[model samples]
Target: MEKDILEVERKHLSNVIKECDEKHLLEVEDKFKLTYTYDAVGMGENRIPYEDVKRLSQSKALLEYSEREQKEILNHLKAYEFVKNEAKSTKVFDEEKLKDIHEILVEGIFQGGCYRNVNINIFGAAHQPPDHIKVYDRMAKFFRNLEQFKGNPLEKATYAHASIAKIHPFVDANGRLAKLVLNYFLIKEDFLPISIPLESRETYIAKLEKFKIEKDLTPLTNFFKDLLIKRYEEVLKELDI
Candidate 1:
């Protein structure tokens, strides 16, 4: 959360993931074996790769809130220490949890879950979204159907995130919300939280566009899995976990 050059790092995995690659990111960075645990995924940079992760790793479980909300989210995630059963802690994730996650994120800050009736564009350009009625049903199912995904973690995440963005569920914070939802799944596992930078939004959008239109997740999946592998390698040395 501290501002620095490292904090400003950006990633471009939008190739397969519907959301911007760097929109939500886990800050951990380190080197490790290049092996990846996800399925049928390929890795790339300055290119489309790493669609999304479904392992419930901590990195993808975070909600993207303002500074104050970030603190609240951190506190809430940390509060899991009080729970006796680990699996019970995040296994029952639902919309209420999503709301709570968003609530905590915007706890003392503005730009929270409040939706804007006004129309907006994807990447603030052409692809303008239609009215609420057009997007609501799809958006509602987007989160509801996550439990139905029998695919591997990456596949579910890739599907969920890409679908969410495709619907453009929220008016202003679709990307943030999508990232937050993705991270919530990541945390149920144990990976660190990650994000995409705003400056890199262009590349992120370009890649995201491919996923949106073509429905291909290889690029996004590859980007995230490789990052996770790299992060796992780095943190493995530091935390003895």
Candidate 2:
């Protein structure tokens, strides 16, 4: 967290916000919501088309479909909406809040919010996540550390992302849930929400692997900082600022 880098990022972010008036903010907000939903859910093997994603995001009434593709899009849309709403609140990132977020993401994909009871290991991960039985305890330690953690919002959110992913508290949607929570806190702190694009999935996984193995957050912090900068720059371009 170099002072100079943060200062520059903040400057660009402020410009992006100031440049986007109310109408532009609304337009950018819709675009951002759709972009993030697509970026997140498009990582699956049965990826939905961009047009379908945009259409789904614009609808209010939940469309029911037996197809897995339609179901996945709706799940992500619901989860994204939940995160956006939760970001407006001033709640602490506690166990209950974490479970709520997890439930929102995994509502139809799996059992909503329960931690995994069976042991699991990531396929090619550099380090093993905590055992299922130890998941609760590890998360407790994480909450304690977060309470005392003093860092910039990006740093704290990075730590939050890494710690929760390493713990692997839930059986499914752990990564997505962690990302939403990180963005929740980031937006709560007045920083723009970051969407880790599907194109960067490998790099994101690598950074998390490094974190789990070496306890080094430098790579992930840089990753998020760059995303924030990209988001701001994109806003500027969209608004012709």
Best model number under lDDT: 2
Give the Cα error of residue 196 in candidate 2, in Å: 1.3
Q: What is the alpha-carbon lDDT for the whole of candidate 1?
A: 0.46
Q: lDDT of each model, Cα atoms only?
A: 0.46, 0.79
Candidate 2 lDDT by residue in tens digits, 97-147: 888877777666677778889898888777887788898788889999999
Clashes of each: 39, 0
- Model 1, range 1-241, lDDT digits (tens) per residue? 6652222221222222233233222222211111121111111111212232221123534343234423433333332221213323745755555555445434454555544456666545434555666665665676567867676665566666667666765543355455555554554554444444434456666666677777676777666565555554444444322
lDDT of 2 at 161: 87
What TM-score against the true fold does each predicted structure earn?
Answer: 0.55, 0.88
Q: Residue 18 lDDT in model 1?
A: 38
